[model samples]
Target: MDLDPRTGNWRGIHSAPRDGSLIWVMDPNCGAFVMRWDDEETNPMFSDATGMWVASDGSMTWCEDTDAGPTWWKPCAQ
Candidate 1:
């Protein structure tokens, strides 16, 4: 398990996929995040607030209950 970059807590994991991407496994507390880590930095897989997903692509997704979903998200200036 690796430390969540957002919370500095060692309660997350990063799995290398067969597609060469990444799958971040956060803890149960939903207080941290993990993203596709290639270099030394691990991108926090959070759009605005607490949430849970075995994957991430910058879209609103539901992995489990609604109460544990993201509480904040803003449209990127794209």
Candidate 2:
């Protein structure tokens, strides 16, 4: 995926129909990343305030904020 140069909106790499554009915002103070789609506000994606990390072996780890708890993503998914 890439961002539209003129609008800063992200688009899917493929030509398939997309649900909506995603927006990512990072809060330096809180060290959390937040994601939102063009039309949704009631259910936005959010990461924990602990920050995200990528291992040297080409894997990533992070957590998503949700009602259940912080959803963790480990290197195994990579």
Candidate 3:
């Protein structure tokens, strides 16, 4: 995996936006690309089984829901 030049986050084969509001992250355990909010605190509705987040451009992504909070994110397929 390589860091996205635009956002400095991991990039996957499928391309997505990295405009600073959200970023792509690679799951160390599965090697899958997930999306996470650049600032988790801004997300007031974060919770288990409901980790879906939308970017400024209306692009949506999901993250794993866990007791530790939203963990691994799975980017929506293009």
Candidate 4:
């Protein structure tokens, strides 16, 4: 991950190729998960999605401002 001090923004990469060019932020209220990847060539369906995550359980759900419903997260594997 790299931080741009001027904008207080971040960029990062993961092991998977599909996990391309990530943008990140911290939820001021909760101080938890908040990240996005909107590049069309990388991720299409979730282009503008944003979500919170539970590290302990590996769970997340994403929704957009205009979305009628939040995207569902699959339960953690046993």
Candidate 5:
């Protein structure tokens, strides 16, 4: 995945896996942030529904409720 430093947007070079597992990377060449879902975890912070996403750089973000849905990504509080 590649993260745009200017927009905080990302795109994956390859399609993400279908399995319910999470992936994270900290390499500069691949950008400093990466996250995927894992369904087996019981913690809300790890749940695909209400998980807290933390980048390798220590930045965090999470989903928020909206008319569109719970897919809106909001920056975590410092």
Candidate 6:
């Protein structure tokens, strides 16, 4: 909220992500329960995507091909 003391003006305000602020990179091939060893960040959560590339920041992204096109998804809700 913003207000002008001298002129008695006021305005209400709110802000949110235009395209959503959350992005979760989940390996598409992982099932509900699986365990694997990773060479990147220690103790990093791993999924079974058949193939995955984890950057130094521990962010993971993968891609798969389909008849229509490439589909992408973030596994995490937040």
Q: Name every residue pair that clashes in candidate 4.
A: none
Report the lDDT tens digits of candidate 4 across residue range 1-78. 223323534222222122332223333233323343233322245555443222332344323333332222222124
Model 4: lDDT equals 0.31
Tell me which of candidates 3 and 6 scores higher on lDDT.
3
lDDT winner, 1 or 4: 1
Among the numbered candidates, top lDDT falls to 3
C-alpha lDDT values of all predictions: 0.35, 0.28, 0.41, 0.31, 0.34, 0.27
Please, what is the TM-score per model?
Answer: 0.23, 0.20, 0.27, 0.24, 0.24, 0.18
User: Once superposed on the true structure, which residue ranges of model 6 sit more than 4 Å away at CA?
Assistant: 1-48, 64-78
- For model 2, the superposed segments whose C-alpha errors exceed 4 Å read 1-19, 38-78
Q: Give the per-residue lDDT digits (tens) of candidate 5, residues 1-78.
A: 334433544224233342533444232332343444333323455354553333334355423222222222222224
| CA lDDT, candidate 2, residue 73 | 16
- Which candidate has the top score in TM-score? 3
Summarize candidate 3's per-residue lDDT along 5-78 as a digit string, tens digits: 34534444234443443454444544444444442423344543433434435454434443333333334445
What's each prediction's clash count?
0, 0, 1, 0, 0, 3
- Residue 11 lDDT, candidate 2, scale 0-100: 27
* Candidate 2 residue-wise lDDT, 9-62, digit = tens: 322222212243322332222332223222222221452234322223323332
Error of 5 at 54 (Å): 9.2
Check candidate 5 and list the clashing pairs.
none
Off by over 4 Å in 3: 2-20, 32-48, 53-61, 67-78
lDDT of 1 by residue, 1-78 (tens): 323445433322322232324444344456433333222222255334333343345443333324563222211123
Candidate 5 regions exceeding 4 Å error are 5-9, 12-15, 20-36, 45-78
